[model samples]
Structure formats: C-alpha cells, structure tokens
Target chain A: MSATAVLRVDNLESYYGPIQAIRGVSLEVREGQLVTVLGANGAGKTTLLKTISGVMDPEKGTVKLEGTEIQGNEPDRIVARGMVHVPEGREIFPLLTVAENIAMGAYTRSDKAAINADEEMVYSYFPILKERMTQAAGTLSGGQQQMLAIGRGLMAKPHIMLLDEPSLGLSPLLTEEIFDIIRRLNTEQHVTMMLVEQNAAVALDVATYGYVMELGRIVMADEAATLAASKDVQEFYLGISQDENQRGQRRWKQRKTWR
Target chain B: MDFVQLIVSGLANGCVYGLIALGFVLIYKATEAVNFAQGDFMMIGAFVCLGLTNADFMGLNFWLAVPLAMVIMAALGYLFDWGVLRHMFGQSQVSIVILTIALGFILRFAAGTIWSHEPVSLETPFAGQDLRFGGVVLGIDEIAIIVVTVVLTGSLFVFFSKTKLGVAMQAASQNQLAAYYMGIPVKRIQSLVWALSGAVAAVAGILFASKGAIDPSSGLLGIKAFAAAAIGGFGSLPGALVGGLIIGLVEPLSARFAPDGFAGIARIAPYAILLIVLIFRPGGIFSQTQKKKV
Candidate 1:
C-alpha cells in the first residue's frame, strides 16, 4: 500500500443527541489497503463509519477523503465524492429487483458503457447475484444479501468503500466466503476499504492494518500481523480464551491505548 | 343498453375520483403523510385552468391551458413541501394531518378569492359532443376521462419501473436512509413526488371542470377520493382506481336501483365502501407492498 491515505478521520467526535457515540477517534486508510475496526457491540465502531461516510454529522472532526475535508456534507454528496457506504443490517432495496438494486449503486455514474462493464465485474465477484438478478432483492438469503450488499458497493467503482459489518449476521462459512472476496477485491481490484467488524479473527486475517476500539475510543492500532499476535486481542476480541476459569480476571486488565 | 350506458358514465365519474385518489396515494406512498388538502389542490387546479382558458382571464386555448395549469400546480406543490412540510419532519403524523387540513382551508379560501363562490363553466374542445354505439350513448368527456386516466396511469407505472429516477424514487420510498447511502437525493425525490401528485390532481380538476359547472366547493369532492384511496389501500396505485370505480358504480346504481325514498344515501356510498373496507380488508385489494425486512 502507498503512503498516501485514501481516508483520514482526525479526532472525530459524534453524538446521538446528547450522548457521544464516537469520541475523538482518529484513523487513516492508505490507498489499496483493507483496514478493519474491531470493537464490541457498543464501542461505536458503526458510528465511526457512519460519521466518516457522512451518514451522521460529526460534532468535532475532519473527515478527509483523499485529503479533501468532507465532514458534515450530505451523504449523497459524500457518495458522489467517491466513497460508498454499505450500511449495517444490509439495507438493500427490498422491493426492487436484485438487478435494479445493483443499478441504484451506479446511480451517480452516467457512462453507459463503463457502467455495464462494472456491473459485469460485480457479478463476477458474486456470481449468485447474476443468477438472481431479476428476482426481488428481499428474496435472497442472508448470506447472499450480504454478498449483494458488497456487490452493490462494487458497482459504484468507489475510491474507498466503508463496509459496516459485512459478516454481521452470517454463518461462519459465509463470513469466510465474503472475507475471501473482500481480500480478492483489495489485492486484485485495488479497492481501498475500511471495514467495521466484530468478527475480529476473520477481519484481522484479511486486514492490512487494524484498530481496536473500546468505549468509542481507539485503544490500539497496529499492523495486522502485530495485532493478531497481541495477546490482549486474542483474549478479548478473538474469543481465544485459552483458560476458561480466569478469563474474566485476565480480561479485566488493560493492555495499552493508541495515544 | 341503459345498463351499459350507466356503467360507462359511472366509470367516467370514477376516473375523476381515481385520478384524485392517485394523487392521495402517491403522496402517501412516498412520505407516509396523509395530505388532507389533496382535494383543495384539485379545486385550485380547476380554477387555474379556467383562469387560463376563460376569455375574462388569460384567454389561452384549452389545450394550452390544461398543461399550463398542471405545471403551475406542480410548482406550487414543490413550494409547499419545501416551505411548509419540510419543517414538519419528526413531528407526529397527526401534526402533519393538521397542517394539511389547515392548508386545505387556506387553499379553498384562496381559490374562492380568485374564482369567486359562484359556479362557472369551462369551455372545452369536446364539450357537448357524444358518441352513440348501438343505442348506447356516451359523452365524449366521459370517453376522454377514461382514456386519459388509463394512459396517465400506464405512463406513471413505466416511469416508476423503467427509468433511473423512477427507480431511485422507489428506493427512497422503500428506505430513505438506504437510498441516501446509495447517492439518491431523497429530499429532492420527495419534493418531485409532491410535484407529480399536484400535476395528477390538476388533470383530475380539469376533467372535472370539463364535465360540468365548477365552484370553490368542488374540492369537497376529494372526500370521495380519500375514500377511494382508503378503499384501494392508501399506497397502492391500481387499488386507488379500483376503489374509485366501486364508489362511482355504487353511487348511480344505488340511486337508480334502490327502493323508493332511499336515494338520499346514494351520496354516502363511497364512505360506506370505505367503512366496509376498513372493517374487513384494511390492506385494500392490491396491497402488494410489504415493509422490507432489514
């Protein structure tokens, strides 16, 4: 990956009404890199992505996309600037046919020939979407929906894709299948991605770098191999509690913070 | 022959009701806000068309006046959403209902100021023309209503289904946040939906004016359209027309076929159908849209 950052969130602070959800979080994803954010359910991993993608406005932050500050702009404007967010819970257009659902991803593009080629590229990434192209998107199984969600993101030909929990509710096998494609896209398609995942094992396996968040703050940041080797990550996030008896006591200790 | 004539005439009247109901349903489908002023919009549209075509007003040709009136209504509709309704976001649905009801009163008063309370007639190219087919007589106005309604409905279906903007509209209606994530301008699409609804209301108003004399009170006819929308299911396009047809058919048939001294209830037939539908299948006949599972 290049030293130039594709996305940069500096000291971002976001709130849900009065309560802050993402607190002074800073991260950067370099070009052609697959970065993962690891956090528990309430650590605000989703909110961080939401803020960066312009779905939620940040109270104090600068979201720079390719060094252009884009905080507080409308989501569509952010999307037009070449960042596509595949939101959590797979918010695919249900009533629309699967093909139409994919077509919506390319709503901003006007190049008819390039769009058709991109559609083919997306189908190649997820062949099942091609077979179910005419069917209503709602009919797809959960795993396929996740794949479709990612495929929809692929249709944008986005400069950076923010994936919020691609393996959110999928089976382990399906998560592996999706992560395989995610890795393929990063290496082959040169797609820069910042993926929010609680599935740390799979996430760290594919990510070039990872950030571990705790209570809306980044507690750790390191290269993927180093993060994977860290004993604290294995116990807390990776579910690799080797000894069942003292697991709680062992997790009560703090390792380190990024700052 | 008389029965066929009654059916045709009823269908024509239903077309007017159905067109108005379509506006009702379209707005409801996109925003989930019940626009109580839908009829008032029709009232204003008719008056506007009259003002455009009448010798006392703009004195434009009928063909020119119709589209012009529709365009005028569409702009007003866009303004209404941008100015009034946009602020009502996160407010209760009841608040929006009250807002629309107040808008209805204002529209009626404004229309009365422009056109007066007195009834008036509009000059149409096809006025007083009738076609007879094997002893069954049909007014050209009635034929025009049926033909126009069918054609408009077909075009709208194609627009929503085939076009990119139309598909974007469907996406916005289904899930606004998701649509926004996909780069669809949800707010603009919603404002456009309001504009489209206004244009539909204008067509209904013009057809209504073409059929007979009109006054400010003609907007009260929207209650039947509301009934039609409810009967068709609030969000279903085809259901609105079918519901309006039921009301139209029932009105004449109830008046003509009922026992003596019971004709007074003919006017309330639409409401009665609305009541029946509410009591039984509240989802309407063609309630195919389901809330998407996230």
Candidate 2:
C-alpha cells in the first residue's frame, strides 16, 4: 500500500453561509497511514471532512485526490473516485432495512460479485447486521447503527475513508470497539483513513500522524507520539493522565508555542 | 337498510379517494413535498385511456388501453421531472410545493385546451352492469374501480418493499444526502418517484372515470386526497387509505341523517379530524416521529 499521497488538501477555505468554518486548512493522507484530526467543538472538524468529501465546496483552496483536483466535485462523483465520507451523525437511512442500507453503499460499484464479497466482509465485522438484515434501520440501537454506517462506507471499496466522530454518543466499551475496528481496518485492509474525532486519546493512540486544530487552523502537526508527549496538548486537550504501555505518555514540562 | 346502501356507496367513493391519497402519500414519502399536480396526473390518465380506446388513437381494448394509459402517464411524469421538477430540485420546500402547483395549473390548462372542459365518459369492460350481493347492490363500474385501486396499491407495496430499485428509493427518501454519498443516483431516483406518482394518479383517474364523467376541473380531486393524507398520517400509505375511507363514509352519512348543509360539514370533517389528531399526536396515528442525534 506504500505510494504517494492519496488525498491532499491545500490551503482550503470553507464556509457555512456567511461564517467561515475552515480557513486555509491544509492536510494530507498517505497510502495506508492512519491520520487523526483532533479538535474541540466548532473547530471546523466536520467542515474539513465535508470539504474533502466534496459535500461543501472549498472557497479558496484545492482538494487533490490521486493528483487530480476534486475540490468542487459533486459528492457522488467524489465517492466514485473512491473517497467515502462516513458523516458526523451516523446518518443511516432510518426507514430502510439493514440489508438495503448496506446495498446502497455499493451504488457506484459495477461488479455485483465484489459487492457481495464486501457485504460478507462487512457482516463479518458486525455480525449483528446479519441478524437484523431485514429489520428497519431506525429500530437499531445507536451503537449498532454506527457499525452499520461504517459497514456502508466499506461497501464503497474506498481507497481512503473520512470518518467524523465515530464515538460520539457511545459508552466507553462501545467506543473502544469502534476504535478497534477502525485500527483493524487500517492494518488488515491497508485502507487509508483520515479520522476527525473529539475522542483525542483514542485517536492519538491509533493514528500514525496527528494534527491538532483550533479555531479552523492546524495548531500542531507531528508524529502521534511526539504530540501526545507535549505539555501544551496535555493541559489544553488530552487532560487525563496517560497510563503505562501507552506510546505517548512522556510529557515535556515546558509549554510549547505555535510556530 | 337503504341507508346501508348509501354507506356502502360512500365507502366505495372513499376507496377511490384513498387511491388518490396513496399517490399523495407515496410522493410525499419520497420527496416530503406535496404535489399539487397529482390530481391533474389522474385526469391525464383517464383522458389518455379515453383517447386510446375511442377508435381514434390505436382503439385498443379496455384492459390493453388501461395499461398503455398508465405507461403514457409515467412517461409524462419523467418529462415533468426533466421539464419543471428538475429545476426545483434541492430548492426550499415551499418553492417545490409552489412549483408543483404551477405545474398542476399548466397540466389542467393543457388538458382543457386539447380535450375541452366538458365532462366525458371513459367506457370500461364493465361499464353499465351492477352486481347484487344480498340486499346491497354494487355497480360493476364501482366494483372495477375498487378492484383497480386495490390491485395498484398492492403492486406499489410490493415495488417499494421487494425490489432493489424500490429499496434505493426508500433510502433516498429517508436521507437524500446519505443516499448520494452511498452512490445512489439520487436525481434518477427522484425522477422515478415522480414517475411512479404519475402512474398511480393515472390509475386513480381511470377508476374515477369508470363511475361517471371527468373534466379538467376534476383535478380538484387532489384536495380531497390531500385531506385524506392529512387524516391517515401525511406520509403514510395505510393512513392515506384509512383517511380516505373516513372522508368517503362521512359525506353520505352526514347528508342522509344531518341538516341540509351537513354535506359541506362532512367535506370539512377530515380537516377537523386532522386538527384534532395534530393537537394530540403530531406524528399521526401510525407514523413514528424521527429522532435527531445531537
């Protein structure tokens, strides 16, 4: 899976009505690498994901996927190009059956056999979906619906997935389960992922590289281990004490300033 | 009782109303926009059937002509998407609703110009016969209307529940943005929904025409159907039917038993019922309210 960058956002500016949500934010995702975008509420994490997935068109910068500019492309076209965005709220079709919701994820794929294989793979990851295949999606518990949302994205056969807040309203155990599945997706399938999450601790743990965003700007960007060690991050962001065996527990006493 | 016969007649009328209401419900479920043109689509269907079997255009048998008319209406629905609806896609809800009303006016005007505004009968296979069951007698044309409505509703239920395309449409209706991300051809599905609505409207029109005469003003029939939708639950299929039946039964009962102007009151009954239901349960009798995650 080693190759040049699969997705690159250069100086992107995005807007929601008159308000600028993302101002000159630039990021990159390399092949098979897990990159995490950590930010607080209203820091434009969702806007960034929307822009990269072509839901919100960039006001200033270019979003290049596989070396082609795709900043202003329609969502379906961007999806067909193999970048799937599992949106912030697990927006599974409430009225649709579980099997129908999964089938929709393969709307662009031409190969029926491959889609079936992917469906099987998704069912393997969340076997509960198989039990509830014909049941209405609205009937599922929140955690199960989140699993279905992820499974639906996988149906796209994405080269890279942009996930927004996968652990929003779940218990600690369910959150861990979600992060584990994400980690396995990255390691086993070698699928590139750009995760935007408020769960900074789990995100930092799993990510190869991390970016801390504040007020729609990237405040810090470094290897996950180094950023996790910074005193500034611990005080302002990752406040909880890191346990032993955690990769990014060592801290610098001195607070770091932005470059 | 002779009163029982009138009640039976009202029930049959309500069934037709239910069919039209189902079209409203189907389109509303798909788009969340009330199609004011739905009744016009019904009128178009009957006129098309009239034309096809009139010995002037193909002159086909009633059964053959019926399916052909539905097909033609479906095609017009596709054209409606390409012509008027496509422009209003993703616009505000009020704008879409207004656009469809404008389309309804256009359709009514066109039908008037081509066929004239006079009442016209569309001959059917069982046009003049009546069947007696016990003391109650049912006209063959009325029975045919009921049968057509039931058959079309069943087919639509199957189409939405069983087919791959149907499931996709349901997915799109629930959350269009998510459906788009999933790679469903969201635009095509919307168009298909419009087409399906048109087909259903045509069937309703044919049934209406079977009983008596239809004219351009017949498009006003959608108002009753809209009332039915409001009664049954605005976006529910079963609700639409139930609502329609309620309205249908009330008019005759009210006219027969109540004061002279009670028929008008009966006409307003569904809305009054809708208001009462809305006060108590905003989500309607059978429908569930959607929950939003923060």
Candidate 3:
C-alpha cells in the first residue's frame, strides 16, 4: 500500500451464493486521487463496490479505510463512515419526491445545520434537481436520474465516493458532462473518487490512476498518461491503432476539454 | 326528520368501523401484511378497557381508563410484531396471511378464557342519552364516536405529513431496504407501526362496545372493518373511512326499507364496493401517488 493510501484491500474475496464473483483481488486507493477501474461486463466491478460498502461481506481478506479495519460492518454503518456507494442502477427511491430522496441521504447526520448546508451544495452542483425538487424521482429522465443518484450520494458528504458505471445508459453529451463533473469534483472539491467504468477511453481520459481488471484480477496498473500511450492498451482497450494513436496525441494537444 | 336521524346514527356507526379499518390500512401500508386478527385485536382493546375501568379492579374513571386501554393495545401490537410477524419475514405472502388467521383464533380463545365467553357492557357516564334536534334523535355516545374519530384521524394526518419520524415510516412503507440504507432503523419503525395500528383498533373496539352489547365473538365486526379497508383501497387511509361510511349507510337503509332478505345484501355493501374497485383500479382511487417502476 502507498503511504497516502486512503483505502487498502488485501486479497479480498467475495461471492454470490457459492459463485465466486471476486477472488483474491488486492488494490489500493490513494488519498486525493481519482482512480478508475476498467473492466468488461461480469468482471466483478459491481461486486467489489458492494463488498467495500458492506452490502455484501467478503469471505476473506482485510478491507481497511484510513488504516482501520471496517470489514463485516453493515451498509448503513459503512455509509456513516463516509464511504458512500452510488449503486449501479441509480436506485433512487422512485416513489419518493426528489427533495425527499435527497433528504433521505442525510439520514445519518446528527447536525441539521450541516445537512442543510450540504443540501445547498448538492442542488448548486445539479441545478436542475432544484427545479423539480418536489416531483417524483421516477418521472425524471434517465440522465437526470443519474445526476440525482450522484447528487444524493454527495448529500452524504463522503470521504471517498464509489460510483458504479456512473455514465451507464447516458447519451454521448451527457456522458461527457458526467465525466467533466467528476473531474471538477476531484480537483475543486478535492473528493477522492474510485470510479468503475467499462468505457476505457473516457476512464483513462479523466483518471489520475488506472487499473485494468479482467476476470476479477488487476492485469495492469499504471499512471493514466503511461497507460493511455501503451501499445498493448491502445490495441486491446483504447481501440487506437498505432497510426491513429499518433493522430490522437496530436488531437489531444489541440484541446483542453477535461481541464 | 326521522330519516335524517337514522342517517346520522349510521354515520356514527360507520366511524367506528372506519377507525378499525384505519388500523388495517396502517399495517398494510407499512408491511404489506393484511392482519386477519384485526377484529380480535379490537376485542382485546375492549376487554382491556373493561378490566381497567371495572369498579372491582383499578376502579379508575371511565374517561381515564381509555388512554390506558389504548396503551395496552399498542403494547400488545408491539409484542405481536416481536413474537410472530418478525418471525414470518421472508415467508411467502400466503403464509403470512394464514399466520394472521391463526392469530385471530388464538386471540379469540384467549379473550374467551379470560372473560368467560359471556357478554359485558361498558357503562359509560352518559349511557342511554339522546339529543333531539327537530324531532330527530341522536345518541350522545354515537356523536362522541364521531368526534373521537375526527380528532384521531386529524392527529394521524399531522403525524404522517409533518413529523420526521412519520416521514421515515412512510418511506419505509414504500421501500424497506432503501429506508434501512438511510439509517431509519427499519425494524423499530415496523414495530411502531404495529403498535399504532393496534391502538387504533382498540379505540374502535371501545367505541363499538359503548354502542352495543358485546361478547368474545363480537370480534367478528373486524370482518366489517376489513371490508371497509378493502372498499377504501387496502392501503389508503381516507378510503377506509369512506368505505366504512358506505357500509354503515347501506345496512340500516336496507333494514328500514326492505326489512327482509335484503338485510344480508345490505350488510355486504363494503365487500361489493371492494370487488368493484379492485376490478377497475387495483390501487384504489388514490393510487396515482405510487407506481412501481418496471
């Protein structure tokens, strides 16, 4: 584990009713860094987040947050410890009002004034949520619901945000906006993020560090820039041919979109 | 004038059933469990009031004993949750319904054991008194039932709408797992809901006993209340009241006009309404508020 590691996982093994979803996987998320785990479908990305958030218990191995073991705690206790999971499907309470959904996220907080302030911060980040605050959450469009899911997680004031496929089912423009929001949250708000994404291109574009997960194991871990330029990554994940890689580098230089 | 008086009396009687139906709605909303033992719980509530207010026992004043009876009924509800309902978790809905049916038998037997299966009348301070208005006669006891139901319903509305705990209960009713994630202490809320429902049943039971003669078998009135709940929409609060009113009106009106075989048909008005409503709109009239996502 690195000296600045905020979360440390040692040989974490998780299962779904005797079917092993994750087997002996080890990873570390460092403080103030945006880390992305890129994996194909059924590669245990969702299971890992569920295990870390205490929704599912790992059969073995230690999971420590800030050097303290927090394995086997319930999801609510894990959430109270400031590790909030924005689940894969944007499971916002459909019948609840948008404002009610946001308020519910602050259920564990003791300080009403602090919760109120956080509520302000969340609505400011997603101004559209404020406009339809009292509307039923199910009525929101797919992109808006995703934004609400992320915003609801933000209402918890998490120390480390674990987002599972945050851009799933979103349009190209909305996907870019979601990633840009992630970038701003990482840099401006200084929130440590661990994003699980199948979109390798966009994940590497915004992430400070990247890990390639195949069959529940980390096959590659490197700085984002190095991984993006690697020939193996270009062919297998990034879909950039050797000639196109050169063109992509030139095109990258002409834009500062992520910054 | 006579017709107006009869309607007023029927409305008052309907309020009693409505109160019990409200209990059915409360538990159904929170747990999605239809408690077949609701009428038996009401019976227990009346028995508790009889025991507490009896001159031979606590010798407590009748008015003073009412709240205590409600408290005892609520405690029984909490115990019932802790003892039976909690154990039935993860069981099929049919199994739960059957378990409640079994509980009804147990409650009836227990009440009979304690009170000897005989009739007992709760003598109120203002028993057998009628207020006459324009040659129309209205029993004070009946008027009292209406007043109490209005007050209780009003307070319950405020509780569900304004309080934080109430909002948490409503959230839990919609999604138990989601409520747990919000740190709402879902188990405790479930228990509280049971207690509240039980207390409401007890109120209805006491009101019922004041209006008529009672025996252990009087718990059968729960059938009428259950019908009222179904008529109003199984999970709706105000629907129960309206169902109860419709049921109440149908009975005497039929008894007065037809005065024969039609009495049975009139008594079943709430059930008929329930069937018609379920056929057209399964969620009830207020179903627009909640819709399941595919």
Candidate 4:
C-alpha cells in the first residue's frame, strides 16, 4: 500500500432523524489497498458506507475522494466521479436483463469500445453471467445476484469501491468463492476497496488492514494480521473463547472493556 | 355488411380511447400516479388545435396546426411536472391521485373560460369523405384514426426496446434509487415521460375531433378509457390498446343487437366487463404478480 490515501473520511457523523447512526467516525484507505470494516448488526457499518457513497448525508464530515471534497454530492454525480457503491441487499435492477443492468453501471461513460471490453472482462470473472446475460436479474440465485452486483460495480471502472456485506445471504462455499474474487481483484487488478462485513475471519484473511466498529464508533483499527491474532478479537469476533464453558460470559466482559 | 361497418367504426373509436388510456398507463408506469387530468389534456389538445386552425387566430392549415398543438401540449406536460408534480415527491399514492383530480377540475374550468361551453366541429380535409368497398362503407377519418394508432403504438414499442433513454426510463421505473446510483437522472426521466404522454393525448384528441363535434363534456370519454386500462392490465402498453378495442366492440355490438329494454346496456357495457375481469384477475389481463426477495 502507498502513503497516498485514495479515500479519506474525517469526523463523519450521520443520523436517521434525531437518532445518530454514525458518530465521529474517521478512516482511510490508501492506494491499491483492501481495507475491511468488521462489525455486527447495528454497529453502523452500513451507515458508514451509505454516508461515504452519498446515499445518506452526514451531519458533520468531509469525504475526500483523491483529496477532493465529495460530501453531500448527488449519488449519480458521486458515481460519475469514479467511486462506485455496491449497497447492501444486492439491490440489482430486478426487472432488467443482466446485460442491461451491467450496461446501466456504465451509463456515465460515453466510450462504446471501452464499455464493451469492460463487459467482456466482467464475463471472464463469472462465466455464468454470460449464459444468463439476457435473463432478468431477479431470476438469478443469491450467489449469482451478488456476482452481478459486483460485476455492475466493476463496469463503472471505478477508482475505489465501497462494498456493504458481500457475504450477506450466502452459503459458506459461496462466501469463500466471492472472497477469492475480491482478493484477486485487489491483488491482480489493483482495485482499491473498502469492504463492510460481518464475517470477520474471511474479511481479515483477504484484507491488509481492518477496523472494528461498535455502537457507531471505531473500537479498534490495526493491521489485519495483528488484529486477527489479538486475544480480544479471537475471543469475541472469531468466536474462539479460551474456555469452552465461558463463551457467552467472555462476550459480555469484552463489550464492557472495549467500550 | 352492416355488421362489418359497425366493427370498422367501433375499432376506430376504440383506437382513440386506447390512445387516451395509454397516457394513463405511461404516467402510472413511470411515476405510479393515476393522472386524473389526462382527459383534460385531451380536451385541451382538441381546443388548442381548433384555435390554431381558426381563420381569426393562428390561421394555420389543419396539417400544420395539429403538430403545433402537439408540441404545445408536450411543453405543458413538462411544465406540469416542473411546477407541480415535482414537489409532490414522496407523497402517498391516494394524495397524488386526489391532487391530479383537483388539477383536472382546474384545467376543465380554464378550458371552459377560454373556449366557452358551446360545441364545435374540428374541420379536416377528410372529415366528410367516405370510401366504399363492395357493400360496406368506411369513413376516411375513421381509417386515419386506425392508421395513426397503429403507427404510434409501433413507434412506442420500438422506442422502449431500442433506445438508451427509453431503457433508462424503464430502469428508473423499476427502482429509482438503484437507477440513481447507476448515474441515471430519475427526476428528468419522469418529466420526459409526462411529455411523451401529453403528445400521445394530443394525437388522440385530434383524431376524436375529426370524427365528430366536440364539447367541454367530451372529456368524460376518458372514463371509458380508464375502464379499458383496467381490463387490459393498467401497466401494459399493448394491454391498453387491446382493452380499448374490446370496450369499443362491446358497446356498439350490444346497442345494435340487444332487445328493446337491453339497449341501455351499451352505456354500462365497458364498466361491466371491467368489473368481471377484475373479479378474476385483479392485476388486469396482462400484468404479472411481482415477486420481491427478502
């Protein structure tokens, strides 16, 4: 990873009406780095990604994409600026054919040849999509839909991608398959990524750096290897309590100390 | 031969109703709003074309005036979206329906004030001309309506399938937030849809006026068009055309062939068929149930 940060969020705060969802959060992903944010449900993981993608406005923050402030920009404009967001729930256009759905991701681009080449490149990643290219996206299986959503994001030719829960609603085998692609995309294609996930073990395995969030705040931030080896993470997140009988008890103890 | 003549004329009238119903379907598909003002839009088209072709007014010939009126109506549609409908985003469906109804009344009053309540004929070169084939007679005006409807329907089918802007509109209709994230301007597409619907309304109005005299009350014909939409499936384009034809065939066939007391059935025939179809398929004949994944 380089010293230059591709994406930087500073003192970001967000809310749903009066209740705050993200509070004073700050993070950075350097050039060509894969950073994973690990948090359980309601930890503000999704909210943070939403804020960064301009889907939700932050109460107070500055989101800089390549050192340019992009906070409060329209979502379409944010997409056109080369930052693609694969939102949670794999919200692919259900009624459109797979080809058309992917085409929509390239809506900001005017180069016809480059767009076609990128589409062929996506088909190389997932051959099944090519077979079902003309089929409605809603008919695809869960794993295929996730691949379509990510493929759609890749079609944008983005500098950085903000992915929210790629492992959601998938089997362990499918999750591993997706992580392998994510890892390859980062290492081989050199695509910068900020992934939000609940599956910490797989997330840490692929990411070079990681952040742990709890109750809308960053509880820990460190190198992925170091964080993976930590006793606190092994016990709470990795579910490897030292004492088998004390599994439930250790989580309660860790939560208090971490807060 | 008389029966074939009735079928021919009925199909022609049905084409006009289908065109008006298409305005309802287009707006409903794009914005999920039942625009009650669609009939008034048709009324305005006829009145504007009349004014433009009158010797004392713009004084343009019929051929030139019709297209001009269509252009003006399209602009009015865009203005309606920019000035009124745009602000009503995120409102409840029932409220939007009621708002459109209120708008319909306002447009009707405005039309009445501008053109008065008296009925008038819209003059066309082919208005009184007729063509004979063996024992059957066909009005040239009726043939013109059929031809225009076919051309308009075919063009729309091509537009939605072949054009990028049209596909973008379809994507936006399916999921606004998703389309927005994909860099499509959703609000602008909605406004464009309104404009397209208005242009279609103008063509339908012009065709209807060419058939006979039109009054302020002619806008009531939109009710039957709504029934056509309901029977054909409210969201499907081809469904609107087919539904309109069915309603057209039923009314005339019932009135000419029914016994003495049953002659009154012609007025309620369209609604009665709508009711029966809804009882079996609430989504209309052409609509499919949408499935959402949890």
Q: Highest lDDT: which candidate?
A: 1
- lDDT by residue (tens digit), candidate 3, A1-259: 4548888888999888989998888888998899998888998998888888777899999899888888888777878888888877677777778998888787777789999998998888889999999998989988888888888888788888898998888888999998998898889888899999988899899999988777877778899889888776776677664444544552343221112
Clashing pairs in 2: B232-B239
Per-residue lDDT of model 3, residues B154-207, tens digit only: 999999867777877888887776666555667778999999999998898899
Classified by CAPRI criteria, candidate 4 counts as: medium
Q: TM-score for every candidate vs. truth? A: 0.97, 0.89, 0.89, 0.95
Which residue pairs show backbone clashes in model 3?
B232-B239
Scored against the native two-chain complex, candidate 2 gets a DockQ of 0.56
The model with the greater TM-score, 2 or 4, is 4
Kindly provide the TM-score of model 4 when superposed on the true structure, using C-alpha atoms.
Answer: 0.95
- Residue A94, model 1: Cα distance from true site in angstroms: 1.1
lDDT of each candidate versus the true structure = 0.90, 0.85, 0.83, 0.89
Off-target runs (Cα >4 Å) in candidate 3 are A1-4, A230-259, B259-261, B288-294
Best by TM-score: 1
- Clashing residue pairs in candidate 1 (N, C-alpha, C atoms within 3 angstroms): none
Tell me the deviation in Å of residue B51 in model 4: 2.3
lDDT of each residue in A1-259, candidate 1, tens digit only: 4379989989999999999998899999999889999999999998998889888899997999999999999988888899999999999888899999999999888899999999999999999999999999988999888888888887888999999999987889988999999999999999999999998999999999999999999999999999998877987888676444444444445544343
Q: Candidate 4 — which residues are off by over 4 angstroms?
A: A1-3, A243-252
User: In angstroms, how far off is B210's CA in candidate 1?
Assistant: 0.7
In the range A130-157, model 2's lDDT, one tens digit per residue, is 9999998888998999999999999999
